[model samples]
Target: MNENAESLSRRLIRNFNTAPTTHDVREPLYDSIGARLAPGTAAQKLGASIDTVAPGKMSCPYHFHYAQEEMFIILEGSGTLRVAGEMLPLRSGDVVFIPPGPEYPHQIVNTSDQPLKYLSVSTREQPEVCEYPDSGKFLAMASAGGERVFDVVQRRSNDLDYWDGEP
Candidate 1:
């Protein structure tokens, strides 16, 4: 294997050992969602896993990838899928796919009273830029300084573009 691949594998194992297996509360976007990322697994590029969310919680913010494609297969409970511009109901045994594009800002929200469980799979090497259209937030991965951030609105001074004068 290549050096980078070997290094990533080692890092993944280390992260799995050190990272918390489960979080008690939901993350940045969800109200009551919690996740348990499987250790030593790479879901984004190499495919990592095992996500659980509580009722009224969201799997993620409404966002779309630039290069990565993601798939979610429901294992339990029910939820609502906000994809493209529509909200569709989802339940156990349901499968949803989000392809790379700005047209689909996808997210899952649990409306049922029980916990929601699912397995998410994706390719490891994809460079992705995600945008939350409703919130006007954008995040770009694979950048040198880590995640790049942007706002979706025009600035007060129309004379300059968004990234033209920033540090």
Candidate 2:
């Protein structure tokens, strides 16, 4: 097969079960496999991924985005959607919409004995800021050319004055 033939065949089509894994987190509280699906296609303004979280784990901390909105489509198993200090039960076929801002800080907790799988979609907003309430930290990230150029995480208590470095 020609080089272009193989590339074109897989560019626009993908199965979540067989998608290429982009990230696998096995931290103490986080255990998940993220399969990025949008990067394989021509999508520029949106991002999509399928994440499978192991039982009794979560994919990320309770955080809220400042610029990008997100949606989650539960595909298999059951979990708990922890949002804004509330614990909401989640099951297969559940659709969740999270708007940007601290008012909707959220995280997925796999409360089931089986792996919880969901399709996560979000706006590809640059120079995004995410605040983690539980950790008292925040993340600032920026990307260019489909690559991350800047990513920083700092605690809220360590913030500097606007003119700290100014003459």
Candidate 3:
């Protein structure tokens, strides 16, 4: 075993005794969302992280991934899962799998009066591109060899027909 692998595995086991936590926030950039108990900088380097959401907050933008796949397993409270064009009501112990593709743009919104928690797992080196179908927003990781960069674009309507006031 290499030194890097051994060091990482040791850090993972020893670091969990006191995990980092983040306060939930109502941020517009994330599209009306919040997260608590999110892994810190070190944990992200390992692979995945856990997140908690409060009531009236969304887990992420209603989006789909092109490379990274995510699974959300509810730990508490009830929420609505907007996947594809359908909304699935979810509660404690409910699990949802979002495969990597354009077909399943998924987001979880807490509708109950309590906090909801879940674990988010993905490969550390996977490249991801996310698209919000409803808002026509796109975000992807840029390859700049520096900090993670994002590209945003809005979808334009192709139908250019003019219509009168009458239906």
Q: Model 2 misses residue 92 by how many Å?
A: 0.6
* Top-lDDT candidate index: 2
Q: Which digits, one per residue and each the tens of the lDDT, describe model 1 over residues 1-167?
A: 99998988765653323445555554655754333353344433445555677777876667777777788899888988988889999999998887778877888888788988777776543345666687766665552222323324332334466699689
User: Model 3, 1-167: lDDT tens per residue?
Assistant: 79999877655553322565555465742322223232333455234455666667786678888877777777667878988889899988887787788988888887777876666665444355677787876666653332456664546453334774559
lDDT score, candidate 3: 0.64
Ranking by TM-score: 2, 3, 1
| Cα lDDT, all candidates | 0.67, 0.92, 0.64
Worst 10 residues of 2 by lDDT: 19-28
List where candidate 2 sits over 4 angstroms from the true fold: 1-10
Poorest lDDT segment (10 consecutive residues) of candidate 1: 143-152
Residues 37-126, candidate 2, lDDT per residue (tens digit)? 887576789999999999999998899999999999999999999999999999999999999998999999999999999999999999
TM-score of each prediction = 0.66, 0.90, 0.67
Candidate 3 worst ten-residue window by lDDT: 29-38
Instruction: Return the lDDT, model 2, position 53.
Output: 94
Pick the TM-score winner.
2
